[model samples]
Target: MNQLNYEEISTEFKNYFLNNYRNFIDEQIKEVKNSKFLINVSDYTSETIDEPHRIVTNFLKEKNIKNHRITNLYKTFEFEFDFYLLMLTFDERRKMDIELYEEIWRHNQKL
Candidate 1:
């Protein structure tokens, strides 16, 4: 199998995720847009959006990933870590973030 296209494969998978979860993501965006206050540092209050859910949709619209074939693509990964990272529920994904960086950090790591 060709390993040269890992990045390309990953990008397609991500787009596929956004496409699949359009409804949930849009609801998140609308919440952010309609909220009068996101955070009040002085009062330590927050109506902050689940930022991980908002990342792609925040700047880019949902993209229909055409010709995407991910069914067997996951087999190419030797570990479940990356696969789960790609498909984890929002809460679990956030937990991984906090555990990884000791803070509410949204970032990606490729293995």
Candidate 2:
């Protein structure tokens, strides 16, 4: 397998996240709500927000995406959602990231 340069990885990461941002958030919200936890409690509140933030921020760090963008992307959900849903979102995002990386790699090769 060909190794990707830094710029290619960066572009692919940005494209993957920016393109799927809304769907990712929506899926997360759905997952949290579907978990059947009482969302009004303080513990639930902290878990819902903080856990996903940590999971997603860690994912971004692993992917070399800028951490600050997590705040820009994470908004207040009207309904509670599960933190585990972010894991599912991460899986999907990683797949897209791989595709984007390959696409960028192929495009770069043609030049």
Candidate 3:
């Protein structure tokens, strides 16, 4: 992508979090103060085959946002090293953050 397109994509990602997931992102920001936190893009099928996730992941890294794209087991294992994980899904209009609290709760019970 060109510089202008990159900027647009970056802006969209920022706006999506600020507008739709502000509260959740705020909580995650607070958690970051006490521990390592990771935001995982759990599904990659929505992105193009040309490594779109890398673009977004690099943008987040520039903003000091810790994140990982869960495309395989190794990546998932690396991401799980963080204390918290926020999974994201792409919908028709925009990306949506999926709360993993219930899944985490259930996993904790198993342990």
Candidate 4:
């Protein structure tokens, strides 16, 4: 039997989440200036928000953004929906962060 490393297992899980998930970001949410990528998801169905949160949370932790906050917005608007928000900061411009972003991209490529 082949033993899978933690990174491999993690990559697998992240891939699964991205592959089988769909989300819509509200343009009304202001962009973060000089900050890293922000990923937000909303629960408009019976699906749980924990899966995406776990993947995003780990990525944030790896980038040393332990204090990065995740917010849940559940509001009634003639509809029921729950939103999850994550704010991150990069050391440089989004272009410069491409290299690091690629890392996330590559990991996500498995999806």
TM-score of each: 0.27, 0.27, 0.23, 0.22
Instruction: Give candidate 2 misplaced runs (Cα > 4 Å).
Output: 1-19, 22-83
Q: What digit string (tens of lDDT, one per residue) describes model 4 on residues 57-107? A: 665455444432232365333221112222121121223334334444444
Q: Candidate 2, residues 1-111: lDDT per residue as tens digits?
A: 444354554455445544556454455455544543433334334443454465556556676545232212356433312232354456655554444344434444554
- lDDT for each of the candidates? 0.40, 0.46, 0.38, 0.34
Candidate 3 structure, TM-score to reference: 0.23
lDDT per residue as tens, model 1, 12-35: 646655454454445544443444
Worst 10 residues of 3 by lDDT: 80-89
**What is the Å distance of residue 57 in model 2 from its true position?**
11
Residue pairs clashing in model 4 are: 36-88, 36-89, 36-90
Q: lDDT of candidate 3 vs native? A: 0.38
For model 4, the run of ten residues with the poorest summed lDDT: 80-89
- Model 1 is weakest, by summed lDDT over 10 consecutive residues, at 102-111
Name the runs in model 4 displaced over 4 angstroms.
Answer: 1-4, 23-111
lDDT of 3 by residue, 2-111 (tens): 22333454456655534434454345334434433332333222332223344445446655555433334555544430111222323411332233333333444554
What is the lDDT, from 0 to 100, of the residue 35 in candidate 2? 47
Instruction: Name the top lDDT candidate.
Output: 2
| Full candidate order by TM-score, most accurate first | 2, 1, 3, 4
Clashes of each: 0, 3, 0, 3
**Pick by lDDT: 1 or 3, better one:** 1
